[model samples]
Target chain A: MIEIVNLHKSFGKNQVLRGATLKVEKGESMVVIGGSGSGKSVLIKHIIGFLKPDEGSVMIDSVDIANLSENERYETRKRFGMLFQMAALFDSMKVWENVAFALIRHGKLKDKEAKEIAVEKLRAVGLVGVEDLMPSELSGGMKKRVGLARAIAHSPEILLYDEPTTGLDPIMADAINDLIIEMKKRLSVTSVAITHDMHSAYKIADRIAMLYEGRIVQTGTPDEIRNTDNAIVRQFITGSAVGPIKIEGVTA
Target chain B: MIRLIELIGRFVEILWSTLMSFARELGKILLLLCATMKQLILPPFELKNTFKQIIEVGIKSLPVVVITAVFTGMVLALQSYTGFKRFNAEVLVGTVVALSITRELGPVLTGLIVAGRAGAAMAAELGTMRVTEQIDALETLATNPVKYLIVPRFIAGVIMLPSLTIVADFVGIIGGYFVGVTVLGANSSVYWKRTWDYLEITDIYNGLIKACFFGASIAIISCYKGFYTEGGAEGVGKATTGAVVLSSMTILISDYFLSAWLFK
Candidate 1:
């Protein structure tokens, strides 16, 4: 289980996350929905040890990961698989190498053995025979699939996805959402996905958490989130410009 | 009077902040260097990547170092001849050329050349990785990027700069020989004799030592700039330019001090 409590992070004066708290139970898919710059990425980054919180704790499997030493954090990170927003495949490596990265690096698998597994994972993601190609050669959907293959390649205990379907078309996004669901079911991995896509959240989430401004405003099942009477939740879910949520400086 | 006081207060604040920012960045770079050194001493050192960077920083830099050395030597020889002729010390022209090339110009020129070529490239490549989130990906894979990306480059810089400086020194001496013997109609044997007699092993060693430090500084500063880059494409461009400029300035400034310390 991953538990975050009262996380506070600020970059200069922007104050990206303040008192943000959420939790993901073991073997559950928790989709975090937030607008752009809503600190979803910051929250996940804190969990992954990329950023340290100013005033809270990130407990991963009962240990506060925020305070772990660098070596300890690295050791803890071995069980994590993250798919970045842009797929973030190493352009220096071929597609297979990208997928097989964690396996070869941390899993201590031989290159040939890792390659075979990479090929299998690619096939599982519906990408076939593209192992020799570079990431630049792949399309947006293909890159995301490769990213997904890379994420699940090591059978990590926790998988973090950052805006996985942001750039894809509706069909591709739905396909990705289905893949996330399938991967969760197949791997039994605890998943935390940050996305603004409500449809994706509805499809993939066992529970939905909405981050408004800095803090998590609501956490409930997708049905509850959709049917909530809270104006903030309703305004975001309905995709309306007119609401209690102001754009700050813009007059609408 | 009140307006002037406020203006002075604002200027002081800006100046203080700017200096503080510089100090902060310097501290970060020093920390990065220490981490790179620690990772470098650990087992599983990357031999292949180090050799690749050596080729990139040393072998690929050969032509530029050669051209710079040759011109510098040729100019030094000509200038030395003009100065010594009036004093009837023409025989000492080769000695001056050899000493200046071995003790100063060789390492400094080679450093600047590599800084422009390899340092800028390192910064740009790493900056691109930063913007593309590949560096963050390395972390997620449980790989310390300092070990994987930086240590190899630092090793290459430390190992290859001296080697490149040796090439630059030899070629520069040969360039001086060419100008002195062939171009200026100076006696070939006398010129060679003076060069060999006056140039000591210590001079060459000092220059090579400077080259090693120059190489490490270029690598560390370039990697540091690249690693911390933000703002996407424009940031990468700025980092690349900054790497080249800063590395070049460092080489020149530190060359003076290293010369003083080594030769004092």
Candidate 2:
């Protein structure tokens, strides 16, 4: 469903992504595992047409999204729903309003209909009776659940999760992982998630791709990744400090 | 001699870069203004959001604008009375207060107040949105952040600053009247007559025109700073400060050019 070829991005003198490339099949859950600042977010941003690459193209279903006009890009984005790392709920809005935002704004649904759908999606994400509460009133886990509810509210064809399990307790993170699995099953949509949490990645991803430096270093199933011979992949999965992957801002 | 020449070269280089940076920022601000204008005229007018912003930017700012205008008028009256007393020109105090409030003080004070109040709030709110990724989330939901977020605020600023200035002008004139007639013991009829005779409709309109420009500058600059905010919480703080400072400076600096053009 998505193909990123030879993608390169630089912020001034800092070169982030260099020749990064990856692809994901439709209706499959693809998880990208990377350390912090590995350009995982940059890669997904390109897919969503949020950022144009300094080089190469991001193709979605055969159309290069980078080349689309602003209006056309907005049209193409309707198929995507993203849950940000911070949940990124509109603090000004109620939980239900946040969930129903795309529905009322883009889908042009009536408020009553939108609210009903928002409530339904919230329930699906195991959240109930917190619809009217503001985002500031919600717990971190609850916020993530609300974000998930919002992401799935519009019935998007492609769902993107950015560090969905981060900043939550182990149990909450695992719950989020389970929710990701449940969402994939229920919606049958293509998903691309980026995270450094190996457990969450293993649990939710049908296929896992490891992003290193700025490029995809390896792609494999969870079992294959766990048993891989590649030193970088093995070191990453094992959570070893001593590895070929140099820890940024640290002297070896 | 060689060292002096090197220092001169370095200074020139620094000056050139600073000028270039200023020009670049100005260009970006104009581009953002153009984008906002395009979105505003296009279909899907966010009347509801615009009204909401109008309330926030105009109605909420009424008390401060009124207070500032009243005090400014009173101060102007008191100062002019004292100064004109020396020349036996006490009768002209009303004319000075009315002319100053209507022609300059009303819009400028209102603009500065709104920039500090509404403009700072805009920068902080949008900066928070940017940092939290709510803006990106909006984009993913197929909404143009510019159209959804900026255009309404822009419309509200353009509409409300002038409305606030009108209120400021009236309240300020009344304030001058109160000081001149009741407190300062000037002739009530003389004060009213002089104010009416000297303050033209064109003077009021000129201030209002300046108000519109100030309003546009505040909204666009605030939105620009907030939209491009990076580096998280500290960045939001910096953007808020930059918005208020830049908007106020723009109002004051542009007031000169606007006054010269409109009054001339």
Candidate 3:
């Protein structure tokens, strides 16, 4: 279980997160949906201990990660697997090397053993016969799948996905959405995904949370979120340009 | 009077911000250095990466360092001939070339060349990694980036600079010998004898010491710039440029202080 309480984060004058609270049960898929720069990424970064909150407690399995030492934080992070928005594969490494990076480094697996697992994971993610290729050679959708393969290579207890379906075609996006669902079902992993893709949210989320104006405006089952009467939620779900939720610095 | 005061205040504000920025960067660099040092002493030293960096910084840079050092020595001999001929001290040309190359030009020129080559490469590579989130990915993998990415490079820099300087010094002396004896009609035996007589172990050691410092500074500055890069492609370009400029400047400036301290 992951619990965040009253998270407050600011960058200079821009308050990205303001007293935001959220929780995810064990073995549940919770998707946080919001527009760009809506603090979804920030929330994930805080939970992962990449960025500390100004005032909050990120409780992972009831242990407050905010107060952990550097070494402790690293140990805690070993339980997590994150797929970045850009599919942040290490360009210097081969695809197999990128997938096996965490396993070799943290898990202390031999190079040969790690590569075997990397190939297996790649196959699991529906990619094959591209282990020796560089990330530069992979297509956008392939890179995302490779990223997913790398994330699951370590078999982390928790999975975090940032903008999973952002830069893919509708077909590729649907494939990824399917993969996320399949992975959750197969691995029984507790997952937190942040994406603006409503289609993806509805497909993968057991519970969906809407982050607006630095706080979680609503969190409910996908069906409830679909039927919610909140004006902000409706405006966002419909992707309307004109609504009570103002696009800052732009006039409606 | 009011306008003048306002102008002065604006100038002070600019000056203050500049100073603060410099101070902040200095602090960050110092902190990074401390962390790197701590990692150096800790267990699990990365030998493979250290060897790779050594080959990159020391071996691959050999051609450029040789070209620069050889040309500098040849030019020094030719110019010294012109100056020494008037004073009837043409025999001392060999000693002059040997001393200058060993004590100053070899280390300084090598520093600048490596700063341009290896330093810029380090910055650009690390900068790309930063923007691409590879550094963050390393952290997620439970790897200390300072340890995994930086310590090996730092080790290579400190160890290889002096070794390269040795090559530069010897090659530079040979360059001077070719010019002094072949082009300038100086006595080959006299030139060789004079070079041997005037060049001391201290001069060579001091120069090597300077090269080590230059190497460390170049690695640190380049790594630091790349580590903190924001924005994107433009930011990486800026970091690469900043790394070369800062490393070269640091080598030149530190060379002066090092010379004074070592030879005073």
Candidate 4:
């Protein structure tokens, strides 16, 4: 349901996306994998209108976001929910308020009704007796769960995950991965995720797209990604620094 | 020389771009306000949030404000008396003190002080949120960052500033009275009566109006800077400093325009 064509963006001297193009069919889980600072976040933001492409178009369900008015973009944004890399919960608000944030934003339900829905959603995410707790009070896994619950609270048609499992321990990360899979099956929502974490990408993505130098070099299934012969893809999946992906002083 | 020239050009460009962005963001706010004007009078007023913000920004700030205003009033009286006594028109000390404090100093100083306190804090809080991507997360949840987050502060600024300005004006006049009547051995009744005698309705009104505008300007610019903050922790620091400087400058500059308009 998303199409990006000839996307190019530059921040002063550094050009990130140069003629990058890609498409995802409806209800498809497309995982975009790239190294840190490889412009993956920039690309996802373009699709969501957080950052505008310097010279290209992001078409969501046939509506070119660049052409839409601010109000229209906002309306379109309602269909999407983004889970930020850091879980990005409003610290001042409690866990349920964070989850029911969309309900409040949609401006339909009253506080009492919204709180009920928020409690139910929190329960679905395996969080119990936690509505009163602030985001700072929760553990990393709990925060991620709350974030996931918030992302799905509005019943959004599109779910966007930005590094869904970066900071979690292995067990918690697997739990999150299972939740992603469970969410996909239960919601039937179109999912697009961007990540540098391989274990996360492989665990949750239905189809994997490798981003290199700001373009998708290869797009394939999980099995295909595991057995891919492409050098950049191999270097990336294997987590090697001494391959086609060269490093300076930093190690992954 | 080449680098200097380029720097000049870049500074001009940045200025132009900032002005444009400010215009666009203001346009967005105006449109939303017009659309929500009906909602303003509707139910679900969210008065709870409004009261919370007023307490947080206005009530909690009372101690510092009281100290600043009272001490400032004392200082202004002491300084103005020195100048007026040289001309042997020291009896007009009450008039001079009352006029300056009520008409100009009250609002301006209050604006500066609050801008330094609440304005910087607002910027820092919002800036940290922006850097941490919490603001975007707010948007994705369909929260109007302006309404849910900003309107409370805006309303609080408009309400609290006038009260604060009144306090400043009152404190300043008392300070002048202390210096004139007690310190300078003038009659207490005469000094107090003279202070009020010269104070016009417009003088107090002028300062109060200025306070409202100052409050709005500081709230808007500080909130905008923090809302649009990028980078990270350092960026938040920059936004905080920018908020204080920009709000202070806007208050001073706008003071000129407002006084000119009200007096012209």
Off by over 4 Å in 2: none
Residue-wise C-alpha lDDT for candidate 3, range A32-61, written one tens digit per residue = 999888899999999899888899888999
Please write out the lDDT profile of model 2 over residues A1-252, one tens digit for every residue. Answer: 998899999999888899888889999999999888889988889889988999999999999998899889999988998999999999999999999998999888999999999999999999999999999999999999999999999899999999999999999999999999999999999999999999999999999999998888999999888889989988888999998989999999
Score chain B of each candidate by TM-score: 0.98, 0.98, 0.99, 0.86
lDDT of 1 at A197: 88
Order of the predicted models by lDDT, top scorer first: 2, 1, 3, 4
RMSD per candidate (Å) reads 1.4, 1.0, 1.0, 4.1
lDDT per prediction?
A: 0.93, 0.93, 0.93, 0.84
Clash pairs detected, candidate 2: none
- Which structure among the candidates has the greatest DockQ? 2
lDDT of 4 by residue, A86-187 (tens): 999999889988988778757578888999999998888888899999999999899989999999998899999999889889899889889988888989
Docking class of 4: medium
Clashing pairs in 3: none
After superposition on all CA atoms, how large is the RMSD of candidate 1? 1.4
Tell me each candidate's i-RMS in Å: 0.5, 0.6, 0.8, 1.2
Model 3, span B74-136: residue lDDT tens: 999999999999989988989999999999998999999889999999999999999988898
Number of clashing residue pairs in every model? 0, 0, 0, 0
* DockQ per model, Cα: 0.90, 0.92, 0.82, 0.60
